[model samples]
Target: MNKKIINKYTSDNQASNLPDYQQCYQHFKWPSVTTQLNIAYQAIDSHLNTSNENKIALRWLGKQNQCVDFTYRDLAEQTSRFASVLNTLGLESGSRIFSLAGRLPLLYIAALGTLKAGCVFTPLFSAFGPEPIRSRMEIGEANVLVTTMSLYRKKVAKWWQELPHLKAILLIDGAGVLDDGCYALSKLMENANAGLPCVKTSPDDMALLHFTSGTTGKPKGVVHVHQAVVAHKSSAYYALDLHATDIYWCTADPGWVTGTTYGIIAPLCLGATMIVDEAEFEVERWYQILDQQQVNVWYSAPTAIRMLMKAGNEIRTKYDLSHLRFIASVGEPLNPEAVVWSERVLGLPFHDNWWQTETGAIMIANYASMPIKPGAMGLPLPGIEAGIVKRTNKESEQATLEVLSEANQIGELALKQGWPSMFRGYLHQNEKYQHCFTQGWYLSGDLAYRDEQGYYWFVGRADDLIKSSGHLIGPFEVESALMEHEDVIEVGVIGIPDDIAGEVVKAYVTLKSGVIPSEQLQKQLKGFARKKLGAAVAPKEIVFRQNLPKTRSGKIMRRLLKARELGLPQGDISTLESDEQ
Candidate 1:
């Protein structure tokens, strides 16, 4: 076997100084599985008759100042009602229902309901504008949609007749009665009272249809099986170290995998209560929620963590956050410096985890209550086999995939093929599905290296490699260099095409509190990064902004920046923010 790509992180794992992180945040320790439903359904069936039925499952807070809570029993009943309602609208097993909402309790009800009743539940970015909403509705063949009346009026009302697949629109509101064109969700729930039965299906049964940003090209549909849901239970509880009673909150919106897995599926599978606040990140409000709610296991992205870091520890210190046990970051890797700052200021090291939409849920992460390294994304979950594929020194192409067996060499991240939660296939795109893997190994289009002790460190994305004037610069290295500065809160380094240098590195930054965007600070940072990283890798330009365009999960959209600069059509502005960047 080609050991270079095979054990990409093994060398780095061996070199890591954090021994505790090596043991607790380890990989490949769980039982093997082949399905998503087996895990989720088992939880529902086994617990349905038990007294644990009344345990709290969800606590939702809408963006418009609304609150609702549910127990397992309530979930069962609501899901059943959701099943009956959707079925009445003529949708059956294998049909599709699209839910367009952030982190609403109803969205969960509709999703689990659709699964039990044998329909594919597809949730899109709730922040997506009308165009994306219409496009997805058409492509997914989604006939039935559940959304608020406002979303209908703002997005779908004008396009209703134009949608050939969309037959009915259900409206949910703070208060409303059931009607023909629009059925009031509250009254509909009152009508369909009892619990619904789950369909007798194997792990291979289609459970969800997720749409991934066709960054490689066009948007494509990804199908996930029933067994994928159950696989997430272990991935969430074990890898995330989430507990049964912990008031957990993973800050991703329902549109993303992180939201569904951590925010809904995993928490419900473990019978843990979750806080679903449909609010964006506001420094004071976030701290207030963490303090007021006494949240225990808190999971957010590194981008958000970096923003909080820039917000200054002084604001966070005012709140009594003693209830929090595990503070974790996902979506993006946490920098070592930010991790140290979190430990020093927040009294906890923010654990990092890694996963892709194609993986269905988290494949690697620092487990709850486990030893953690601030910079590493942690080991693969119990049964996952991950390694690095090195670049060969052939005087020809971009890096060739080298399967590694040792530690400390940079390589393309690859996972052992055939995990239970692995995506079934891209919807209607067989060739595209097979293209993601090679020799039975799923190539995660990311770069990572292993240390002496088995921890995986994230490098930038495959396409994020910066080439400037015959020298290649890794954006993360430059971004990390800038992050060390006290004035810098967050930064994204992009390679802007230039006539002279081929491509010049431009850094877009968001600064810390009390730090004004001045010529003095700009020079100070440029000089600091030149010293930290070599002069060749230092950014040539700095564009300071209050924010950078990021996905709902807190990933900086570098493509958006590149697209805007090239004057190309901007794709997927759902998560982009102009004011932030």
Candidate 2:
């Protein structure tokens, strides 16, 4: 298969971009490596400090009916003040600060403030339970933390007494009322200088640390530098078709890398407005925002789209969604069915895209004007080079890594290195970091075969594959088949520990609306799967559920499912829903 980007830009340094104020945009100029990260600094000075300061950047809503709007100017001043406090507290550059809070503005403040102060910021999943949260904080060696009063009083309230590395906790809503031991964020910011000087930082300076969802036990910290943000902006602009006038609402939570990239920096870097909602996924509420906010480019996950499809088209048809220009999918690969359903009901094909938390932004995507196939993850964006490598046949007559140059061949997808947003490293884990790459090619654990048309077809994770009766089966293929059943709203397939066939596929499924829980429905669904794909790939066992556990970004936690099935420790339950808990 050929590389994804049809065109490549000559070097102008890796941090280049067209002026945000340009009247007409044509070709994009990628920034050189020597490009200044002061773009973010200047944005704070120009668009934010002027007439648009009153323009809202985020609309945070609460479960208790409280609402708050943060304008760009408000964000700048608050972050600047917090920067002053951070410096005064002896927090130096490179000092890591791990932060968590229920979808709120303080998460943004702490992140930007940490960066403005020349310190690195790490985000922990707000939904993570105590152990997972503590694991990340301890692993990151975060000297300070910023969170809500309730989270501090309930979660970290006991953590401080245990893990001593987290020296300080800054509470957003607990000011004045918080325990004397914990610092009040509002009071500190009030005491700080709003005119605090911005620190001069290199593009390569450690900017953010995100924890990857480890299919294997412990979560690994992925490090991204300040320069990576610029890379994220360039790629996100093209991949997601984000424009200055575009009112983009990225549904990813701040707890994930996509949230920090698209929801925060990418929009600000280009001087575009970003929408933030503090509420959880509610189909009717989501459509209401699309109409009210006029969200132009909608980027969410396949899981969300499926959930939306289940809600039916009545709510979708009610909205005057003429404003929505494009839609895209992430987190998990989008099924062909979801793509078609989105176009029929939402009035547009929800484009499928692929990327990892480590990569920062969309590396491969189906853009607004790009040609899109129903099931294929479209071409790689400009500046990214990819190829498929056939699995090592230990029993091969001749030995070599035969990169597939022909169509209809399945192989491992690997990226050519030196991309700006490529993760710097796994924090505190050198050997572990080295495992994902060979030479410079980042070995994406995903197995995808490239077609002659330059589109990539996803197989499942390298580990999620099951070998049954000596035949290899991708869990996604089986899971997708199961999802076709009307009774199956969600499905997760794993190779159960089996005796004879080496491994047997067992599907854990969630029922859809109007489907009453009964063995008859389960039997019919299993029979349907058998007729659809063949008995070999059909689930040996069918387990029904009220809901499938998912991350805040709407990705089903497959590892969590596998962990639970074998009575093993469920890894990184931080993103697990409260209802699940």
Candidate 3:
């Protein structure tokens, strides 16, 4: 955990898809684009003629211990039936379909079926309240909604009538009293033909619309096209180390970008078996799934990892996880302690990666065949070109960029344009989308630096930097240091206004299960942080909390903490999953 590089692990018989990074990057080529390029065809129907047709495509575990499996042929037929249902409803190509439900078997079918019919698909968090659901549906101009009867009644029943573009509502769980334009999905699928052909689509045709929340505005819809599957297939092959025979499990809900890109599309494109659990995060339940289902490759977020760390290592000893090979973490920066802890307790280090909703695919990652530097974002993917740059003009119509040359020079992270999965544009916000690029580089708002060996390290977000007495501080550095403390389980740092300095660092801490919170322990933590980091970089003030504000995808809401502390407006709490007491 002392910034020491973990050497890559190799077996005598097994080989990685990317044996050497440079060689693969030099010879990498995108798949040829044909006239009829559809994601559904690539992910599902194309496997119909191969041996993968009989392989289990999905294994769904219900909340009540009900287990169901769907093979490639079953998926093709069910998705085709769903497409025919859409066709029978008079929905044309390019129509928008939005789904709001938990991880049900039918939800997966609906998603692939929507893409098969050449309609745009968007998935909403089932836990979202009424306002968030209404706003996203309104912004995306939802033409069809797929949900359960309970969700429709609780969240969408009252306000859905106001949306003019909504034409149909298909309830997965049939309702006793149906409203206008509402029909049970089972009834529609009963008579629909299962031989519906996949619609022909251009590479650039819109296939998915993912909404991302901003700090002070309505949710911005990020548009992605059918061509994204090319990047999806390649990135998964190299980054996730996925193979046709692997049992893959990505524990992200389809509401967020990671869930859709990796959880649903990427694995399917490679013909890998996917494990989907309809229950929320429970340490014992998750361990049971890994041991019983024999998942080979596991993709998860840092929040769940921290939760498991908090649960202690005793539970893991009861389960046999010999089948698990590679584990990867995303959604946020993985703390160095988590990486070290996983390696010691779980027998494999969690390889951290970097990407955003706009990218629509993994850009930087610690590959299975590469050495890992704890707390680093790893190297850029084979096809990605990443750099650090500084802005030249702040208040001019034509701003410019200066690419930093020296290593360890902190600057905004930027990516060279023209990646296939790169978002085409923001829906109805062309000006905003155009502002994201300058000199052919898409500016990522996150701040980062690269070491001499080309390993990228994440600083906090650009706006999250702390300027105290002429010293620039990234909250991630301070949080990682504090996380080394044995008593601290989770930490969220923010900059608070000070009289002498412009801004000072303030940290909110969540302690371990049995640790008592006393002023002496707080002072000890401050001293420990000061020892790890210098006085200027350490937290000026520390506060104890039961939990920190987080999104449904498990990213800490540092901006929310700063706003609540300063009594400023808490903009866009729609995605807020939990709040600190």
- Give the number of the best model, judged by lDDT: 3
Candidate 2's clash total is 12
Top TM-score model: 3
Per-residue lDDT of model 3, residues 1-581, tens digit only: 44433323212212354458878867876667867689999999999989999999999999999999999999999999999999999999999999998899989999999999999999987766565678778889999999999988887888798899999999998757799989999888889889899999999999999977543346688999999999999999989999998999999998677888898999999999999999998999999999999999999987788889889999999999999999998876787888879988999889999998899899999988777777889889988999999999868988999999999999999999988899999898999899899999999888999988788999867667665532345677678778889999999998887643546889999999999999999999998887556464689899999999999998889989998999999999999996755
Per-residue error (Å), model 3, residue 508: 15
lDDT head-to-head 1 vs 3, winner: 3
Query: Could you tell me the lDDT of residue 329 within candidate 1?
Result: 74
Give the alpha carbon lDDT tens digit for every residue of 64-146 in model 2: 65668777787778889988888878788888888888678778877888888888888766755564567678778888888
Give the total clashing residue pairs for model 3. Answer: 0
- Cα lDDT of model 1 by residue, 367-406, tens digit: 6434555567887776788889754654543435568878
What TM-score quantifies how close candidate 1 is to the native fold?
A: 0.73
Per-residue lDDT for 471 in model 1? 36
How many pairs in model 1 have backbone atoms within 3 A of each other, for residues 3 or more apart or on separate chains, i.e. clashes? 47
Displacement of residue 311 (Cα, Å) in model 3 is 0.6
